[model samples]
Target: MKPLVVIPARGGSKGVPRKNIKELGGKPLIYYTIEAAREVFDDDVICVSTDDKEIKEVVEQTGLEVPFLRPEKFATDTAGTRGVLLHALKFYKEEMDYKADTIILLQPTSPFRTAQHINEALEKYHFGLDRVVSVKETDANPYFVLFEENEEGFLKKSKEGSFKRRQDCPKVWELNGAIYIINVNSLKNEEVSEFRRVKKYVMDEVSSIDIDSELDWKIACSIYYNIIISRNIDSK
Candidate 1:
């Protein structure tokens, strides 16, 4: 399958200021994703779509050229990822004459997601499917814990179920925001949220950690120093 890997790294981050390029474990946060993508795909097919020049430079440090600076309109906090993906696709198709059948979206926030995870997800994808997105089994099960307020301002279970224990509740998957292998034709026709033929690629909690807060950053750093680093050393 012809695939184009898109790594979306925007400059403005409210959760953690300058988060895309912020240093983590002695390397820029985006570096981990770029490195992982490089292992699975060629530099030509990988696109780092960023509006910030600093982000472009950081990506280029690894020798993968940033194709183009995203337009100001698509770089705002109000901008959606659908627009960014379309813009990148348009650039490649119109300017470079490269058309990709599949779009592999790798957000820079998930540092623990490695090349192996990407490959496994790709294996689960086919042109027939709308998307193969990575997910972790959610802790907040609607049948057990999740609730909603009714007209009387009373709490009610989000989903109607007679399950007495949390373990007995049906497993619910939470999108981990790590990997998204999308069908180009399906994406062109509708937004990702509208896709009905989506599939899940299950990932463990540790690998599914997506850093969007100060506490998340600390946890990521702790995992890097304590677990990931140790694993590398042990393998050697």
Candidate 2:
């Protein structure tokens, strides 16, 4: 099935400041995602949806298409991810008359994904699966170790507290938001319907980094550097 790559980048970045365009390892952070997509898909099929002119320029420099800019309203901090994704999907269909069986939603903050990881996720997305996302084994399983705050301000366990041993609890998956390949039908039908069947392409913690803040950025860099060092072994 044909695929379309969508990179959603907005201008206002509060955490890291101009994060999407910021250089990571000498290349703009978004460049990694664009490059990986290029390695796996044609340039015409890849699209970067952004609101900032600077971000658009960075995307074009990578030789990717910025088919449409997300509306300022939708690009605001208040706009939810679901709304942003729905708007992007609608834009390509309505404005560009583009259609793809698979809509690949890749977050720029996740730069560690390799072309191999992308292909692995795609391999899981056969006709049987409705959606596929990059994920990693969670160190702390939410089913066992998570907590919830009650209205009385007491910290209560998210699940039953009776499970005395962490190992006894079932393992649960946490989405790493790196790469997601969702069926276009389910995407337009309900904006990533929670009820839709989903699959995962599990990656190691090193490559599964989700850079949400300064700390996350640091951790991701460490992981990236480590991976590079390992690859350089015996090359000398």
Candidate 3:
């Protein structure tokens, strides 16, 4: 299926300021997502939607053109991801006259996600559905470990289950903020937040690392360094 890959990297990052352009694993963080997209699809089909001029310039240095700077309204901290995606789809359709059956949203935060993960998710994607979002098995098991305060201020299990051990409970998944494959027609008709029919693309914990805070960034760095060290040792 023909797909348009959109990598949204707006400026005004509060956590780890300028994170999109910040060096991670020896390169700009966004470069990882852009390169991964290029590995799977033609460069022309991959678009970097950024509101900051610096981000656009940095992305251009990677040899992939930034189709357009996202509008200021969509770059705000309160702006929803769905709006940014819709604007991108509109730009491609009206300006470039390029029509794609599906859109693959790859957030720059997920640097560990690679072309292989995207290709596997694409193989599982089918039209007429809302979306296929990447996820990882949640480390927090609500059934046995997590608790919520009741109206009476008493703690209660978040999810009631009879399992004696957390491992015995049914597995739960959470969005990894890595990849989202959406049906173009479905996206145009309804916002992604409103979609009820969604599928999950499960990824391992390390691959699902999404850097949103300084702690997360540090963890990513440690993981990256370990991988590099392992590869280098094997090469010798």
Best by TM-score: 1
lDDT of 1: 0.96
CA RMSD, predictions in order: 0.7, 2.3, 1.5
Q: Which ten residues in a row have the lowest lDDT in candidate 2?
A: 187-196
lDDT of 2 by residue, 84-177 (tens): 7677767767877876778888888889887888988888897566788888877676667788899999987786756778887777677888
Model 3 lDDT tens row, 24-143: 978999998998898999998998999999999999998899989899999999999889988998899899998888999999999989999999998778986789999999989889
lDDT top scorer: 1
| Regions of model 1 farther than 4 Å from truth | none
TM-score of each: 0.99, 0.89, 0.95
lDDT of 1 by residue, 139-168 (tens): 999999999999999999999999989999
Evaluate model 3: give its lDDT: 0.91
